[model samples]
Target: MTSPAIPFVASSSYPVRAGNRVRPLIDGEPAFRRICQAIEMARESVQVTVTFMWAAFEMPDGRGSTLDVLDRAAARGVDVRLVFWRPDAETERHRRNAFWGSAAHVGLLEARRSAVKIRWDRAHPGFCQHQKSWLIDAGADGETAFVGGINLNPHSMVAPGHHGEGHNHDVYVELAGPSTVDVHHNFVQRWNEASERLAPDGRWGAGSETDLPFPTRIPAPCGGATVQVQRTIHAGRYCDGTAAPGGHAFDVARGERSVFDQYRAAIDAARRSIYIENQYLDVPDIVDCLHRALERGVDVVLLMPAEPDVTLPVSPERRAVLDSRARLGAFANFMLAGLAGLGADRRRKPVYVHDKLMLIDDAWATVGSCNLHRYSLFGNGEMNVSFAEPDTVRALRCELLHEHLGRDTAGLDDRAALELFRRIAKENRTKRDAEDPAWQGLAFELDAATHVG
Candidate 1:
């Protein structure tokens, strides 16, 4: 049967878009693998905006590093542009390396001498330019884009069906059709502004001499799904604190919170269940809405990391992870569960859940960089692609559950599937405490609000 139309709404926050082909790329291996492939297939341009990237990190299959891949693409005449977060003084020490285009970083780019150019943008000092996105040949018939929270860090390089330290579970949506125009719009806005901040210190070389043009017309439709390109952007980041001229309704000067608006509205409209997999659950508004949904008999299931990523022995950063965990533990309505995997010593090891995802009633879904945390929902520059396609949402839910629980929902309805997860998670928690010999898989429910971070 054909699924009902999603009734996607556009307002001051989210603008409605249609005819987008959205595919959920689960785990780092598939997400990065597909992203690299799309970059390779680009005929005109490749634009990437990410929070942080490691200089030494390499793609799976020994492809050197992300820069190496971009260099290869640039050598073939593709205009490769990189926009990386220029971490504030306080945050700089925590990033994998100094921001891109630094003295040392520029030397690497100069050595390649490819068509690649880069710029570093400073966020709200307290927040970050946290969106992870890629746009390929926007405004063209075959244009495509990707959006999600997967960073270019080593912890996010793990393959699907594999487990270890630095193993992070994440998702990125591969997008085609009219929605790619919106992605293109966003890139042009950031790139033009970031270019202004670039110094004449020979960092950008000749590649930064010209600015990419704003998408004049929306791309032709590519598929059947309805989509809304949403974001959380702090005020004054774009458009000189004014509403964008045309084809976009967002005014970052007013502090657009489309992602938060969408989540609350979707929860309010949910009739059966809401499934979420996020790194943090510290937002009070979201927690309150979930409590109300639970009162209306809505089933809520959330997946988070069993142990804080910051708490890892070799992890250089701890304050952010530890701080976020403390706030998440305050949610009264959330029965948070930490995922676990088996250690080499035959003991249960904590599996980190880093994906930001949400599904409602098997009819609506979202996957992207915005976490259910204050910084992400309010202050950070973030982006997410939401769809009202029932088939895609249900399939994504099943895929996530199968990966984590080692079993499928087996044709259960949304509510029943959520209940099954509750039952299995409770059983897993009991087994974990008893030190049972059987494989514990991933889900382990918490008995109290106390956090494991």
Candidate 2:
């Protein structure tokens, strides 16, 4: 059956673009390999928006560190551009493993004699510039872009088919098509209006802080998948009045919440099942939508952190949402689970689920850095590309589910696949409780009541 054409995040700054190709890179090692390869092949530029970067992150197969990767690209005159988050006083405490443009970081760049240009951007004073993206060969025929929640740290650089100590499970989608122009536009917008660009210590590299012109020509289509680039921009963050290629000028003074809007729309539009993997799910309205979907008999599965930080109730909304998830235990159509890694020693360790993506009805999906939380949906500089092509969406679903279930779900329908996921996860949970290492896969269902309570 052909899926209905649903309007995807209509309020985005960029229009829906067709003839695109998307490939999901499931774990950090593979993702970095692909990203580094693109950088090595970059002819025009390599633009990266960084949130958290550690000095420990190195490229695959002796390619050197993260900085080394960018530096090598710059040495080849590929125009490497990096935008690092500049946390203010309020956000400084949370700057863990981040290359937040500190003086020491700058000195390291100087000491290494690196040629990579750097710009430091801040989010709405107290929030975050939590966008992790890459644009390779921007505007060129082989243009490409990548978006996801993967961070540059050792905890994220583990091999796939996890079986080891605690690691971060994440994803990134490689994009090629007309839509790659939007990524180029996003980088230019942020680079030009970087909050600290004028500060004495705001930027690095001589004559590298110059503003970029908005793209005037859209890249030709590359495939059949349709995509819409969406974002969550804070009001008054960028008042430069810039816009993407072939899109309306953004209402920068008013802000945009297309990620939040798209989450609601996608959940509400689900007909078969909704598969979500996000680091956190503390948004009340989103939980309400999930509850309603379960009531409608739509299979719903959410994979998140095994032990997320729980703060004392600060707002009534916070308490209400947690209570709502606790109530999800009563819904038979819902499954709440966490990912785990089994060691060769037959030990179980929770693999932090840091992926922020959703596949709905095996026909639509979104992959990017937008978490199902207020920070990402409301304030952070988040970006996602929502696509509505069954072939592309289903391929991603099969790949991800096969990794988690150790079984091919391609033969099963969406609903049946989710039911199998629930059964296997429940079995894994019981095995975990019995201290047995024999389980079908790494996913193990959790008691929503206890996990959320």
**lDDT tens digits, residue span 1-453, model 2:** 444555587688888888898888999999999999999889989999999998767878899999999988889788888899988898887677788877788889989998988988899977889889999988888999999889998888877886357688899999999899998998998999999899988899865768888888788887888899889999999876576777888777788898899899999988779999988888888999998988888899999888765533447877678778888779888899987778767788887888899999898899999988788899999999888778888888888888888999889988899999999999999999999977887899887877742
Cα RMSD, each candidate: 4.4, 1.5
Q: What is the C-alpha lDDT of each candidate?
A: 0.75, 0.86
Number of the top-ranking candidate, with lDDT as the measure? 2
- Specify the poorest-scoring 10-residue window by lDDT in model 1: 311-320
lDDT per residue for candidate 1 within 378-419, as digits (tens), equals: 888998898877778888888877777777875987777777
> Each model's TM-score?
0.89, 0.97
Off by over 4 Å in 2: 1-3, 310-316
> lDDT of candidate 2?
0.86
TM-score top scorer: 2
